[model samples]
Target: MPQAQQLDPDTFAVRHRIVLVTAWLQVPFLVAVALLTTGLGQAELGTIGAVAVVALGATVTQSIRARAVLASVALFAASAVLIYLSGGTIEAHLHIFAMLPFVALYQDWRPLVASVGFVVVHHVGVSVLDPEGAFNHHAAQHKPLLWALIHAGAVLVTVVGLLALWKVLEDASRATVAALEQVEAERRRRLEDAERFGAELAREAARLVDVSGRVGEVAGVVRETQEASSQRVGELSRRAVDASRAGEETRERVGSGVATMGDLEQRSGEVESLIVLISEIAERTKLLALNATIEASRAGEAGRGFAVVADEVRNLAAQSADAVDRIRETLVAIRQGTTTTAEVLDQVEAAVDGIQTVQAEVVAVAGEEAAAGEVLAAQVHELTTLAGSLSGAAGTMSELAASGR
Candidate 1:
């Protein structure tokens, strides 16, 4: 009935040795008790057979139950042989009681029960069948059955007490073992949790490190882009100022051009007036030439030369009127071209103003962005450092968990 698994390794080892040693020692012990009971060899084959049985059961039995049951039963036989050898001495029975504790050491009641049964059978059977060998006194031989019952009762009482003690021991041992196993189970569970948590933390830390690294790279790129943008904004702003300045100069040039245009307009007006006066003089000359031709016709052949001079004067007046008309057409074209050029200059100045406003705003926004970028880069650097620290902690935890496992 003894289960080896119930005992922890340490207790099992110690009890194992004790049981084996005691079982083996029973052989020599029986021999010594027999010699001590009656100093010499009065018996022959019975003692030898009994001793041999003890030896075989002690030595040959493998299992704890086999060893305990066989050895305990054999000890009863050995004690019976000693009793017979001693002529049924009262003290030879003590050997039977002595072996009980040894089997009781197994913490298994079944072996004790087996030992008791063997003792009962041997006492009744031996006393009834061989009273001379089973009893030392003639009084016991006359009523061996009563004597056997008395001896069996004594053994049962001892066995009952031992069984009580065995019950307490069995309960205590099982409780201790159960408690130890529970502790080991909880310990193993805690270790598994620690290993799982450590592994998970390590993996998450790796991901954090990767993400932080990428964040750092992205921050660097953003920093570079911001720097470039800031510089470009500065350049544009400078260009805008230059354009504003250019716009001022253009305004001044436009003012000068307006003044020049006004002078050109006035001069063109004078030329127009002069053309009108010349046209009037040409008409008067044509009329005077016509009147002279009439007078010369009245004077006949002497007036022929005067009439030819009037015709040349009329041709000269017509040619002068045609030249004045061409001059007025050219003046009108110059005035229209001047007005278009002035309008284009005004538009260029307005566009320059708009460029300057947009450039100034861009520069302001770029400056704010640059400052924000610096702050973001600093935070990202901190995050990367923190992630590294977490990774290191997780790595250390993993090492500890692995070692513990």
Candidate 2:
């Protein structure tokens, strides 16, 4: 059994009022028809007036059951008046069926049942009381019970089919609502998942961007350090080259000093030889003076002066030989000092050579360091570029995440 409570109440309310109010349209049409065909009289006015009262009563009633029952009575009553006013025309009879859809639109079988029941009663009452208003044909007029039963049977059949269809439509509507709710649930879930994933992606992107920024900053610092290192290496290389050059100059000066010392040593040896020859000559002279003194002593008193002169000459030669001996010792000491100075100059030359070699090695190592610094700086620059790219990618991801949220 269908009750007045609708599956969709809001829609039912609007349609319910429309059904009730629009049922009045038939009243005026029926009245006009009555005026034209049967001519307006007391019965027509009385029927139409009663239907208006019933419809108004339905509007005022709070109980859905009473309202539905009253609306149904009004519809059938109006149809009856329309049938009578049309002189029981076939067109006028269609109003009864036409009113059924409005009742069905409310999705309530109460109005349908009530309308069917009212029609059956009205037909039974009318056929017995006044068959002309119900049937225009002779057979329907004569056998009014059969025609009325047939009409009631037809209405019952249509209402049964309509109720079945209404049930089908109602089920379909419920299924549609359920399916829509499920779809909405799925959509909400998907939206939540998207927002969560987007948030995760944004967080990861932010981390990447932050890490990239730090990397870029570190790389930039490293690049600057490497550039400074390269410059320092270059300066060190130049200094090494200058030191090598200075070492070479010092070695050359040392070589010249060593050569000069060797020459001086040779000259000292020659001077010593001359001093030895002079000492030998002085000894021979002393020997000759001693012999002359002995000869003079044999000559007596005249030779006394000659012996004194010979002794004096011997003393002078002895002094000259002593001086030559001291000169020879001094020349030996000079040669010894010259030999030491030559050896010292040689050592100094060797040290300068070692220093030059070390400087050369330093220059080579500095060159290598500069090259390595260049490579390091290039690597740092590449890292900075990589960080910039990461930042750009992160920014794009952040924008995408923002839009998603």
Candidate 3:
């Protein structure tokens, strides 16, 4: 067999089934045509028996090509037997040509040629050996060889034409089978590509989902930090304002204390002047008492009592002068202390002013920090939103990938 004849299993099976069916049909059709044309005669019975035997043999054959050849030969032989039994009727001869077309199903020229050879051999052999049996009484008597040649010629022509047509059909079938195989191969390749693409898509989707999850986590952390920073900044701003106000109040109190210390210094000066005047008065009184004692001493005995009183007066005056001197020293020490306290108050006021300046700067910085924190929070929120969108997109992609798979 040629490579073209070796069909795929399904094609071979289909052709085999068609051949079997045609065989069975041909046998019955031959018997019916023989019986109808010849009536209950020995020739009809013989033809029917021969067809039955051939059909049985073809059916029992195991090899596909053998069975096909047997069936083809049998069909042609049965047509020949029918033509003989029908007294070489033209209609019966037409059955031989009809059987030729069925041989094309085998897709091999061998079966067709076998069938043609069977018909040709049977026609030629029967005509030569038993001319009376091969044709009707009239055909046998009138130029039977010529008529046989004519019939053979007609069969040859039909076989040649059918062979040509069968060749065309076989070529077309081979082309179709080749095209179908190519199509099947392309389809398989495409399917494999699709599977690979789907697998790659799935992996990409999984990676995207993982990245989205990480980004979302980072966004959450940033948002949380922003919130904490905003809160801290707000608290610091409030405290800074409070500290600034306290600084201002402290500065005011320091100014008042300095003023009060200045007044104390002025009062200490007045007390110092009063102590000087008392010291001068005590000196004068002591001098006068001394003079009186001298006058009493000059008058002796009678002035003795007066002199003792003067001496006591002089002692009192001296005591008053000493007390005035101690008072003056104490006042001077108080004035010095007041001057020191005033200097200290001035230093404290300057420190308070510096604190106020520092406090104002702290308040401004705190405000700026709070504003920056709010901006950061807004940015974090935007990032979180973007991360959420990415996560959603990744989830959609995952679902699509899974569905595609």
Give lDDT tens digits, candidate 1, residues 107-211: 665666788888888888988799877888888999999999998989888878877876777778889989989999998898888778767766665675676
Lowest lDDT sum, 10 consecutive residues, model 2, at 1-10
Per-residue lDDT, model 1, residue 385, is 70
Q: Give the alpha carbon lDDT tens digit for every residue of 1-405 in model 2.
A: 333345455675677688788777667876777778878789878988888888888889988767777877788889888887777777877888888777787677677778888889888998999898789999999999999999888788788877887878877877898999999999999889889988988998989898998998899799889978988998888888888888888888888888898888888878877887888889888988989799889988999999999999899899999899888888888888888988898888888888888888888898889878878978997898899889988988888888877
Taking all chains together, each candidate's TM-score versus the true structure is: 0.54, 0.82, 0.82
Q: What C-alpha lDDT do the candidate models reach, one value each?
A: 0.73, 0.83, 0.78
Q: Which residue pairs collide, candidate 2?
A: none
RMSD of each: 7.9, 3.8, 3.6
**For model 1, what is the error of residue 401's alpha carbon versus the real structure, in angstroms, after optimal superposition?**
10
TM-score of 3: 0.82
